[model samples]
Target: MRSTLPTFNEVWQRQCRSSILSDEKQFFSKNTFLVACSGGMDSMLLLCLLHCLFPQRVRAMYVNHQLQPDNEVWATFVQNFCEWHNIPYLIKKVQVAKGNLEAQARHARFNAFQQTICSEEILVLAHHQQDQAETFLLRLFSGAGVNGLKAMQKIAVKENIKIWRPLLDVPREKIEQWIKQDSIPYVTDQTNFDEHYDRAWARHTLWNVIKPRFPKMQTAITRTALLMQDADEILYEVLQQDFKCCGNENSLDIQALNDLTPARRRQLLSWWLKTEYRPSLDTVDRLQNEVMYARTDAQAQFFVKPFWYVRYQGKIYRLTEQQKKPKQYEIEIFDCQNIVLNQKYGLNKDLLKESLMLYPRIGGERVHLHGRVGTWPLKKAIQEAQIFPWQRDQIQILKKEDVILGIITPQGFWLAQSDYCVPNGWLPKLDGVSV
Candidate 1:
């Protein structure tokens, strides 16, 4: 005789006792759970389960993307359900950004969720086994590497917010069965049947046709994702070891990067940039061809959105846009200590009585070195001083009426003219350097 299957509550309790959930028992006990409910079958089941298990610790949040005409209807349904169960509830409305409708809607939804939940709350999602399978197929079709193929996890962190998906390993059929058996109320989203979205197309068009022939495909895909997760962890460990030998958070050593194998080099570059920014594979390839392989003396730069990655002096540095400084300003000598010049450079103390004018460098401008006989072109002087090309425009030229006092380099050092120098005198020091 076939044995009777476990009830939904029994299955949930059994899963909770599993090693993964058991390991996080203390964390789950300490933090309140904010369930992301969309008034859908899966989410409603998650909300119900959590509420039934830990009623006081569970709260429901519904994020309305406002993409559909019935968005408010869904929100009201989730709110009513929460009120009926006496659970704390929050509803956030978000405007989806312009772009791929599905991606933008997802981004907006998550943004709302992230903005609503605090550090003391763990954001719980309702992604199940089939959802993982669908994500795996989507990433696979998009040519994602091991990192992407790993898909979602039971526990993860995003932007310092902890996320938990307790039902991640549970199958969708089981969830539907439990919901129907318990007579839970939920609203159906008609958009799920629309094939215009990639996930919808994969589910309705691709998976439906394949499921009959390969009934166990979802389980197989989920297993593959688990393996990929392990592979991704190993790769991260290797990258950490490689990072120590090469560089730190802000920059990478060009020579060390070049010595790595082509594949490893690409991995390191992708890993390094991903710490603060997301870079496309094409961007990584372009950086390898244009910046890393450029001639040693050549100053090569690759733009990645708002910032630029530049190669100079055997190091690749990420350059953020600096704040715009005044084009020209006049200051008294007594205030020189508050400006951008190194005080060690000698300047006549008597001249402190006169005002000095500071101007940003323009092309063809020239300055005189203190010990040198003649004037030097400002551009040539900056180049000889080894200032970064990106920082050249930020150099300040100091003047006293018609006489050129000196110029302040980006590094806060002063190049005083011979006429302005005294055996021992006062100079100013700038506080910081632009990276």
Candidate 2:
């Protein structure tokens, strides 16, 4: 006779033990395990298993989103359960944001977790194979690519905190059966059955229809997700190479990127955005078509959620919220008798003692500098000199009253030397040295 398959309880215990010994076991062994308990079946079951395995190493946290009438009751139940088991527990209250009920609640809960859990602690959650399958299907229907389809990871690092989902590979039915076999009691959140949430709708309606047609649908979908996850790992290796070649802290090199095919360009763009933001597939496609291929002279910009991408000077740069203020300064040329301007104009005693007003762009300002015949717009001069638009406010224009004398910049000085030439035998030096 063939050997009997292990019971759900035995299999669960084995999986838990196996997971506890994985590479991250060192992390759990060294750090306190913070279990996110919601008083629900999945979380309570996980809490019980962890308490049984390593009682001293774990503590439980219940986040009260206050979305439902029974939130307090759920909190009471969690507290009572923990107290009865002599397990450490905490109840945290959070005010969920007003938009996108599901997303806001999740954000608030995670925010609580982040605020409460320190870097040395690892957070344990109870997401299972069914949840992963639902996420995979939802992402697939929403036109997600390989990365998004990979769905929830068994282990993730966020905000310097390690999150370990121990039951990510375990099926929900198995968890339920294990709970039943152990006589463990857990509260049910009414919202899970209400079906207003996307996840609930997927589980109750879509999953019901799909599972009967294909009895092993959840396992099959999860396997596909694992395959996609493998593909995602390969893509990540390519991403690192591309990023190394064409990326910087805040900008990407367009010239090095142009050597890549359009598909490769898209891949790099997607990878680049993923480092900071999670852009939709449509958004990534638009970025590749509208921004990457635009004319050199064309100014292209796009917003991916909270960040702004700007294309200029053969590079793509992420816009930061830095305020540039136009400033004016007065410098006495006589005081600069030993100062060299632009490594060419050396202030000498023969140069008249005069005060020069330095101002940033004030419309209609024109400069006739560096032996230029006709006057050109100060803005045009700055542009021709390859100054970025955002740096315009910081450009210092050397002036006498309303007349333009020259321009002083960090790179070099562009002064009208003919009008203010240094006399013979007077040298400008920083340390009594002539250049």
Candidate 3:
């Protein structure tokens, strides 16, 4: 005998109610719940159930991707439904850009959610177990490893916002049963059934063929995903230990990193770059094979999103391109007695009275610190001071009309190479980098 699909109320009572209303209240005790209503069956069912559970604490938003011809009609339906139920509603419209239409829509929709969700609120999505299985299979077919195979989580934090999927374990049949039982109004997007889209193709072609041969495929896939998630957690712990041994918080020591196995190196590098840059599996493979074992003198760099992964010296550094600052800036001084560079560059009244120009590091500049022996190259001084590579260009030189007065690194102010005169109660403060 086939397992009977439970009704909406029965499924909710069996699956969600007890946990959501538990005394410990892990999820729903304090945070506001914002339902991502798309006027579709999955989201609408979620909205109805959340409203029933916590009416006063619930809010809903309709994200109109504007991809379908009847999207506005669906939006209107959602608006009217919210009005009837006296529930708070927000409608966000996004432009669906070309190329990877599904991905772009998802990105735009989640951006809207992140922008609209409050700090203390939880964004509720309506992804079900079947969706998770589809994602897992899709990733598996695409040669995805453990991270991608782990698929969606019931509870996740995206863009610093907590997202809850109360119906993650629930099946599509259960949601359909609930919609029918409650007579809930929902608009079906024709695109979902078109089968041209990848997900639709997966549903129509892949799932339809497999569902008959293997009756319990969804459950099996879901269980495998859970196992993968556990494995992923263990891998993260191992990576953390490796990171402690081979890397600092911001950089990886190449010598220490080379000591680890190639697999371990790839794992550590992937985990480190996951936050700011999503390096693909191929990229990780290349880094392991090519970049890691390359000659010590060989300089290699790869673009990792907003920053570049640069191999230099004996370590790997994440270097971002710094915007150029003006070569020189002239500061107009008022009364010398009450000049206001209190937190800035400290200069004497006489120097302030003269034409003072600030110049950024353009290379080959020399500076002499107080009590120091001959002139030192500015770059060497910065290196000795242990400033980051990105901060070197930010050092400023304070000069008068034809002579160098002083220079400012983040460490402190130093006099010009030729001038060593000390002035009482006169200190020029440098703001360092505005560029």
Candidate 4:
């Protein structure tokens, strides 16, 4: 009699043909599959399966944390396996930071993967349904919100590195059975059953007890995480619409942000910050209460690690750490010669021979702006131009001897003095403000 259970190859093929994994199949067909192998049963099976399916496209990467005493032995085993299978592989050694061993190891492992994998290659992980369930539970216990509770995704992109977990929904038992049936050589890590680590405690202790009472607990938890992911997608769609009305690429209108409900306001702030920086919940709360709702005249600013969100002139501008501006510089211009001033705002060839001094705003200065009748106070002019407060110091004042020649604002606008005005002369490119 034939066995009732399907073989590992049959299950893999079925999964690849499934509607959910059809896109992944197409992606893998076109991209190189770089598997993260740990020399354990799960990773070994993943590497073996991918190599069998796509021999020419499969490669393995092993990150050695040097935590366990047998790490070298495990690495050697993986190298031998890859060599036997004629698969190309790389072994990366990473220094795990001195802290929580599990978290540090994971961080080091992913950092190694990110540095090793190129843009065109796809990093494949062996996280299965049981791991997903544990992640969900861990995040829930740690007071994580919906975003965290959603846990691991089947496909994810981090720092421009694409990661695929094809076996995310597959049962761990299936992988074990396949490895046993195939007699695959794999090294077991004793730390997995130590119960000292959080994941080990969850798996060996908590899960062992829970499974006896609720056999389907893993399935239930995984299903809940999937539901949370669906909810997160809907929330993100709503956030996009809200952001469109209240925010632009780099700034958000204060009044419009205030118009949103408290929860939505926090969500928008969190979403905006997460686009480029990871902010904690406390930081978001402070931004809402201390910065966003501060007095109109108050110069409120909040620092969020390498970036600052400052409330200025009815808007919140996200800015990097301000760089020190030079006091002054000199440039020469000749007639019939066009000069490139940085990437944007080039001087006209019609300007006569002159030497101009570029100085930062020192106060009590005036500029006779082109097309304007009288001289305007430099402060008033910058305010009228709506230049950001943090950017005002970056504005350069152009002066030929005692007379103001022009002013270069951070917005890439060249407010040329009336004396230096030439029609259809200065080309505006607006790339970035550079001296």
Best TM-score among the predictions, by candidate number:
1
* Candidate 2: regions farther than 4 A off: 1-12, 23-27, 275-277, 321-358, 362-385, 393-435
Scored by CA lDDT, what does every candidate get?
0.78, 0.75, 0.74, 0.76
lDDT of 4 by residue, 62-96 (tens): 89999878999989998987877788999999999
Better of 2 and 4 by TM-score: 4
lDDT of 1 at 303: 72
Off by over 4 Å in 1: 1-26, 275-280, 296-299, 321-355, 359-385, 413-435
Taking the tens digit of each residue's C-alpha lDDT, what string does model 3 give over 243-359?
A: 999877567898888888878888888877776434688877776555666776665666656656766567777655542122233444322343344333335555655656667
Model 1 agreement with the true structure over 51-88: per-residue lDDT tens digits: 76666788999998888889999999988777766889
TM-scores vs. true structure, each candidate? 0.85, 0.79, 0.83, 0.81
Candidates sorted by lDDT, best first: 1, 4, 2, 3
Give the top-scoring candidate (lDDT).
1
Q: Cα deviation of 139 in candidate 1 (Å)?
A: 0.5
**After superposition, which runs of candidate 3 have C-alpha atoms over 4 Å from their true positions?**
1-12, 19-24, 275-277, 288-291, 323-348, 356-367, 375-382, 387-404, 408-412, 417-420, 425-435
Model 1 has how many clashing residue pairs?
Answer: 1
Assess candidate 3 and give its lDDT: 0.74
Model 4 misplacement above 4 A = 1-27, 97-101, 115-121, 194-196, 275-278, 323-359, 412-435
Q: Which ten residues in a row have the lowest lDDT in candidate 2?
A: 425-434
- State the TM-score for model 1: 0.85
